[model samples]
Target: MVFLGGGMPWYAQFGCGGGGCDRIRYMKVVLQRVSQASVDVVNELGDLDPTFDLQQIGPGFLLLVGVTDEDGDDEIAWLAHKILRLRVFEDEQGKMNRSIQDIGGEILSVSQFTLFADVRKGNRPSFVGAGKPEHADIMWIKFNEALRSGGVAVREGRFGAHMRVGLVNDGPVTIVIDTADRH
Candidate 1:
């Protein structure tokens, strides 16, 4: 389940206040546990927003989480358990039945605050929907703990830091899961 967005396309604009220049649109690709079995997140920062582009490379699953100020320990636990149990892959018999735990995969968890960026009433994006820095940090730590407690070997990008992420996709099998959907 690879999530991609057709972001603003770049075009040549000439004859303005100063001059025109060519610009390439910015895009992000989040490759989760496509090479491993299970992925988990204990907080909302792990969540992926609608604009996020996620690709599940190889055989593992990609866990996209959306963090908010309202997120708590309960939400973190639920997300971890849900990611481990959600079956989106096919089994040996060609049946769509295999949870992350059943296959023993790895997870690539990224801290994406942009997932909570809201643009309801203005041109600029609003982060009011995302959790506060202090709260999010605590939740982020707990979220990873939940995954570890569930016997998952999680590989995560740094939290609250701008990171240059890169991935080499093999099988290109991507899936998206949202804990909020269960509610």
Candidate 2:
């Protein structure tokens, strides 16, 4: 099968081989406004497991970041800004007028490559749209650093590792951002 985009799996269309995802592939971030959030990182290498209680931010965000091969610095920078500046939290007037920074809130970022799962062909999901581990890992770190540099207190799950993420979605406010749509 021939997948129209780059980096699509051979089974994506009808007759296809191997290549990277499309140049226009998007970096996805799933954001949920949260009253509380935490993550436990399990040692997949069978070494030691650690749980990060992190800081107790009464209100904040839980971000599930999905990176694709085509995603890079521009995507990262844009996403970081958007997440930090998004005005989902309510103000004194009960209006959605406060950014995370405005409310002194924290951020919990988790690497979620599965966000790119494609199940069009069968019940099994295909991760062909996700970036390779080596590249994705670097991008993940870059994203966290970017958020920190933006003055947002950030906590993270172990990248490329098994993690137990728990959160309470405040206001049940959820949003999905895709880099492709921005362009």
Candidate 3:
């Protein structure tokens, strides 16, 4: 058996055989049903950057997304479809039975790698589980494109940029999803 990185055997963790590791990829998303949402690009010190801002959505979802190093199209596709079709909005009956598509709502998608923070070790969170900036940018762009192509209007946060996200979570409905459990 071969070991990679730390002391653990590589095959056990990443499913490596002889050639390479088929490490499972995952994406984490926190979805909130929102009456309104917006995003603003900012500097590390939290001052807004004048170059970009997504105004606000009248009604839709605020999505905070995190991608793992191994995440790819498979995770992106599944998540995009799930978000668009998730039945958390209201119908005429006032029950949660309608989807974003059913009501023609918008989406505010934000790249939020902080979702992968591992706080088990101490007070300070570790971000080692999060995907690198370059790969995360690709996944973020693809996610927005997927939503658009699937007929949902998507407003996005600047990929790989520091951002401030603001939202009024409708019904205070929040859901956390990880692609690792889907299979």
Candidate 4:
């Protein structure tokens, strides 16, 4: 079993006996119902690089996503299905009865490995639960594609890049989903 830099065994954790990652723990997503959302790349000097504007969306979801070593297509498929059809938007009677698909909403997805930050020990957070970069990047890209396959417009922040993300929460509605909770 080959361990990565942080003393986390990537090879042992993921049962990639053949080639690709077929199993996973949980593909997590922090979904915020938003009236607006945007993500811009941060330059080396810790400033927003106007030229590298990744994405912005109006009236949709601001998704902060994290992946685990075991996360794979199942997690991606489950999350995409749940999020796209989630009925958080209001209907004619001012009740939350509409799905994002119903309102033709958009999605601004950002790769957020920090979502898995482990703060159990001390002041410093550990990312041992986070997916290795190679796997996470692949799964994240597939997840976005799955979301797009739902027929809603989707935007994304650059993977593995330092980004400044901003959003205006609509209804202040927020949800955190972890596939581990599946029964």
List runs of model 2 lying over 4 Å from the truth.
Answer: 1-23, 44-57
lDDT score for residue 173 of model 3: 97
Q: Which of candidates 2 and 4 reaches a greater TM-score?
A: 4
* Model 3 RMSD in angstroms: 6.1
lDDT of 3 at 93: 88
Would you list the C-alpha lDDT of every candidate in the order shown?
A: 0.57, 0.84, 0.85, 0.89
Q: lDDT: which is higher, 2 or 4?
A: 4
**Candidate 4: how many backbone clashes?**
3
**Candidate 1 lDDT, tens digit per residue, 84-148?**
77775568997658877787766666667787655645699876656678877777777778887
Worst 10 residues of 4 by lDDT: 16-25
lDDT of 4 by residue, 1-183 (tens): 667788876765557444444445577899999999999999899988877856889999999999998988988899999999899999999999999999999999999999987675689997877999999999999999999999999999988999989999998999999987764
- Which has the higher lDDT value, candidate number 1 or candidate number 3? 3
lDDT of 2 by residue, 98-148 (tens): 999998999989999999997767799998889999999999999999999
TM-score of model 4 vs. true structure: 0.84
Clash total of candidate 1: 16
Candidate 3 lDDT by residue in tens digits, 21-90 = 4556479999999999998888876788888855578799898999888888988889888888889988
Point out where model 4 deviates above 4 Å.
Answer: 1-25
Clashes of each: 16, 10, 0, 3
- Provide the lDDT at 9 for model 2: 58
